[model samples]
Target: MVGVAMGGFCLAPFAGPVLWRLLIEKMSWNWTMWVLLMFARVTVVLIATLAETYKPILLKRRAKKRGLPLPPKLPTGEALKLVVMMTLQRPFAMLLTEPIVRALSVYMALVFAVLFGFFEAIPYVFTSVYGFHPGDTGLTFLGIGVGLLIGAAIFMFLDRTNMSLLCVFQCHRRLNPDCCQQKSERWLSLPIGLFWLAW
Candidate 1:
């Protein structure tokens, strides 16, 4: 589910350029900006309304399930301040204390740097070298979009296979101890993908 959701998000980089180009061509840039602003405003309103209603219901349900008194609500300003502090501090704290988190953070930073570099370079390469029109340049991002989809699919497939294997191993281990002594191979695709990207 998460992989599917993330794959959908990964489409945004490719889709954004094409969508923006079409919108600008259909309506002028000024109107395109206005339309986008209106869309963002509506999205924000919906999310805010839903979040406000959802949180109390979720808290109540959890409290009932645990047979505990309802949690006390913090003052709005205090709650916001606490959230802001945690959001600001937690990532840095994890990067400092957790080696895995630090490594992943660096890897993600490098990935984003490469991705954004391509975003800038692709337009120039298509327009100057390939003699493509500015509008058609957006289609050059299709490779990246396809790559993201493939990666997501690979992750989903490998994750499910690993889980099934684990279940089978668990049952076998019940019959024979030490039968399930193997490391998970679910993360094997990560290095393979990285090497493919480098190549």
Candidate 2:
């Protein structure tokens, strides 16, 4: 459900220039805003129909409707304090204490920044370097979509290969050091390392 809604936000940035071109060129600037607003409204309506996932809120609602006893609960202030403390501490602890998670998190952050930065930089290159119009610039985003598909395919292939090897290797030896060595080697593999650097 989260992925589905997130997809719409990703799609909009890629599709925005095309939509702008169509609406502004054929209709008017005002029409573009109106049409985009309509799409926003539609997205809200569709996503609003999704079932609630927050456990505490959902349990409370169900208990009310069915006249059932609610589960024993923490006091509101204490619960809020615990939630806040855990939320902050969990990530901080993982970042400080877990080498693998920290490394992966940092790598992902860099990649994310590069991806969005490229999207923003596209306009500068297309408009200034290539002398293209603003509308034509969105077409260039097709490259980003294609690159994502290819990268995802490669990542899935790498992940599957790792899992299969892990199963086989673990059957032959203890997992701790062996698994870590294999994972590190794979992470340092030249092609994938270069691929990540290219981002």
Candidate 3:
């Protein structure tokens, strides 16, 4: 699921420029911007309407299980403030306290910085060096997008294989408890990917 989501995220950059170019040619740039803005607004509305709040449902279930009255709802302003504070503070707290989180955060930040640098460089390189038109320059991003999809597929395959191996290891450990120790090998790919990108 995560791999699929990441693929979709990668697809956007590759698809978006081409789509925008078509929209611009058809509708003019001003109208294209307005159309995209309307699309975003509609998406937000649909999500807000369709998305379920699991927290409230879970609270109800807990109260029912205990044979107790439902808890009173928090005041709207207070609830909003609490949510805002937690959302703002928890990430920083984790980044400071958790080594894995901190490391991943720094890695991702560097990766995105490099990705954005490519976004700027690709156009200039393609246009100036290859004498490509604007549309052709945008097409250069397809190579990066294809690389992202390939990486996602590789990681997804590794994750599924790892899960199967983990289940087998667990079964083996049950039979000979002291002989096996569980270890996560999924993260080995991260540095490998980074090295590949550097090369």
Tens digits of per-residue lDDT for model 2 on 89-153? 78899899998778767865765675566666766777887798876666666666665555445
Clashing pairs in 2: none
Preferred candidate (TM-score higher): 1 or 2: 1
Order of the predicted models by TM-score, top scorer first = 3, 1, 2
Those runs of model 2 whose alpha carbons end farther than 4 Å from true positions after fitting are: 1-70, 153-199
After TM-score superposition, the amount by which residue 113's alpha carbon in candidate 3 deviates from its true location, in angstroms, is 0.5
Per-residue alpha-carbon lDDT of candidate 1 for residues 79-138, written as tens digits (9 for 90 to 100): 999898799888778889998677667766765676676677767877887799877775
Cα lDDT tens digits for candidate 3, 100-186: 678767866865676676667767776887798765664666676567667657655644555446655563322121112244344
All candidates' lDDT scores? 0.64, 0.63, 0.63
As for TM-score, the candidate ahead, 2 or 3, is 3
Off by over 4 Å in 1: 10-57, 61-71, 75-81, 163-199
